[model samples]
Target: MEILLWIIIIGLFITSFVALFFPVLPSVFAIWGGFIIYHFFLNSGELTTFFWISMVTLTAVLLLADVFTGSLAVKQFGGSKLGGRVAAISVIIGAFVYPPFGILALPFIAVIIVEYWQQEDFLSALRAAIGTLIGFLSGRLAEGIIQLIMIGWFFLIIWS
Candidate 1:
């Protein structure tokens, strides 16, 4: 039973990392799931209140980072609000379309099409698309780092 519980916790942690690229997965929740499992099943009150509070704060930061990075990047490149929305939607859709590669390609293509349609300029559309790609990648990188920190913090608390 102990081994099984550990496996489940570890799996959840791994899933959180996977969620970095696959927008379909709830990355933060998956991470919380691991901590919750450990708190309830394995250690029972082992996690400190400070730990929980910190985790919650980090979660909020992670979410904000994701939204801001994408929107800011798009806007910085002259992409409109509509382009940002389209890029976000494309990310989710891309998750199901062709997987890993789709996640990258779909947003780039979607942003270009939407921006071009709205701006009526190919060069401007391409710029926005490139911005979307950069933003998406930046957001993912931030998310991955945060998730890693969360997991590392959990381990440090538990093991030490």
Candidate 2:
């Protein structure tokens, strides 16, 4: 039973990493699931209040990062608000359309199309598309790093 539970927890942690690429998966929730399993099933009293608080804080940061990074990038590149929203929606759609490549290409294409349609300026649309790509990549990097930190903290707590 203990080994099985450990496997499940580890699987959830791995899934969290996978979620970095596929936005459909709830990355933070997967990590929290592992922690929650450890707390409820393996050792109820193992996780301290500090652990929970820190995790919650980090989760909030991740959420904020997700919401702002891409939109801010679009705005910085002179994209309209609609461009930012299109980029965000395309990212989710891209994940399922063709996987990793789709994740990269779809947002760029969508942002370009929408921006061009709205502004009727090819160069400006291209710039917004580039910004969308940069923002998506940046957000992914940030998420990956933060998730690593969260997992590392979990291990530190458990193994120490």
Candidate 3:
């Protein structure tokens, strides 16, 4: 049973890490869930207070990264506040409307439309759209790297 539990926990962490790329998956929650599984099943009462705090902090930081990066990217690329806001909003709506790809497509379309509406220039709008794409990709990369670090830390905790 102990071996089985450890296997499950590891599997969950791997799934959580891979899920970071998919907008629809709550990858942060998956990592947290793996921690909970460890605390309850594999080593009850073994996790330290510091571990809990670190877990929460990691989750919060990743969540903020996901929420802010797109807007920052849009603005960095000369997109207006309205364009950035639309891009961010479209991502959420896109997740519900399509799923993985929609999350990317809807934001690009929305940002371009809003940028063009504001600037009335096709090239400028396209640039902003590209920025939004870069922002979204960067956000995913950041989350994936953080998730790997967090999982590595978890393994260290368990093995050490």
TM-score-superior candidate, 1 or 3: 1
Q: Alpha carbon lDDT of residue 137, candidate 2?
A: 84
Candidate 1 displacement at residue 55 in angstroms: 0.3
The C-alpha RMSD in Å for every predicted model, in order, reads 0.8, 0.8, 1.9
lDDT of 1 by residue, 41-117 (tens): 89987799999999999999999999989989999999999999999999999999999889889999999999999
TM-score for each model:
0.98, 0.97, 0.88
Poorly placed runs, candidate 3 (over 4 Å): 96-99
Q: TM-score rank, highest first? A: 1, 2, 3
Which has the higher TM-score value, candidate number 1 or candidate number 2?
Answer: 1
User: Which is the winner by lDDT between candidate 1 and candidate 2?
Assistant: 1
Which portions of model 1 miss their true places by more than 4 Å? none
Backbone clashes in model 2, listed as residue pairs: none
Total clashes in model 1, counting residue pairs 3 or more apart in sequence or in different chains: 0
